[model samples]
Target: MTISKHIYFAAPMFANSDLRYNAYLVKKIRQLNHQVTVYLPQENGDINEKSAYADSKMIAQADADEVLKSDLLIAILDGLVIDPGVASEIGIAFAKEIPVIGLYSDTRQQGADNQKKLAALQETAENQFHYLNLFTAGLVKLNGQITNNEEDFLHGIQKFLETGEINDLS
Candidate 1:
């Protein structure tokens, strides 16, 4: 018998791209394992609906409760910076010792071995890669890992489910 797992998906939900990407990844994760239940915050209309009036405390408490209950957290680290809400969720998970899997799919992160890219990093204002807050990223690494793409993210979840541990897949 498969043991059930709860995953809290923390991501930016304001843009069409963010919404669609979150849905797609959540679907893929669900398909990956029948016993997994993903709690996507945007789907919680009570606190997330723009037309509704959920106070800041209400939203924080709600999401924090879910984070505490989750077996794992999948944080999308693809925006200009890690979304503030997502960062808070990460902190909560870190404090509670819940494992977190971060997905950072920025295109600029590609071509790691390219000489030109390496050279550009040395030039002032010529950095080609995006920066992620190291403290937040470190929190994830302490309990889990950050995957660069969808496949690795799913793989990380699978590995975590089967072994109760996560690894650096970068």
Candidate 2:
């Protein structure tokens, strides 16, 4: 069995719908196993009653600090494009050598031309097309996994927690 560890959950928290999804993901992650605690910036940030600018800076810094101290980071990469803030968090996790797991389920076709689609832009080590930037995908591939659904996400987390490693899912 894997020991308990802290995981930073990074996602776009600016929208109401996104916030709700973040909450749901947190709940599901908590239930995935008894050995992991989730640090969700949307819920843990010291943003209450603060000015917009102050709150934004404080929240961003707090999240970054948590990511640095965390054992792992799970990023939500759903949407037309990866959320800029979440992408930054993923980069930080990579730089810190913390394991990362990316969950992206948006299946909408991204571009009008096949050449412009992310999948067509880069092929994985396994020769499969991944619908994400090569650099971003490569970072996560180093120490963690990228999944698109709840089942795969749970499996990825469990696998990472057990072995401290995961495979490239691209």
Candidate 3:
């Protein structure tokens, strides 16, 4: 809890057809007096917000290199399963010795997933990718977990960024 931090956001991109909670989160982080870089999977779908920021889409090593410079990571681990890309990014952050704070709503009690639904296909998942079901696997390595109020979520991340050792998800 004694270090200044540069935060990087890891989550689903705006291109994701499901329209997860990352956008709202990105907006919140922007409101802060700090700059943050986002890392998400490159998606192929109709997206309006996709052009809003300088997104770091992961497709190779350079993207991973970009992530290493961050002092901390805020991962939106909201998915039926832990998003593979987010997990990988988290791992990379771990390798570089950066702390990761995960935030997610507990809405995993939804329903079955259509494993083959095309992005162009119009369908909806039960909740915001159901983080409840994937909690342990998703956040085992994180320094903190925000499972309820947004204030707590924000505070948790802020604490991690400010101190770097609360839960030590790093």
Choose the strongest candidate by TM-score.
Answer: 1
For 38-133, candidate 2 gives per-residue lDDT tens digits of: 998777535532243455677677778889999989988786668888888999999988988988776553343555454544654432233567
Across residues 1-170, which tens digit of lDDT does each residue of candidate 3 receive?
Answer: 33445666677664445355566776676455364444333432222235554434424454566568776677766656656767787778766767676766545333336444333234565233333434444443554454445666677765655555656323
- In the predicted model 2, the residue pairs found to clash are none
**Per-candidate TM-score against the hidden true structure:** 0.94, 0.76, 0.58
**Candidate 3: what lDDT?**
0.56
Off by over 4 Å in 3: 1-4, 14-20, 35-58, 109-149, 168-170
| Model 1: residues with Cα > 4 Å off, grouped in runs | 168-170
The number of the candidate with the highest lDDT is: 1
lDDT of all predictions, in order shown?
0.90, 0.77, 0.56
Q: What is the C-alpha RMSD of each candidate to the true structure, in Å?
A: 1.5, 6.0, 9.4
Candidates by lDDT, descending order: 1, 2, 3
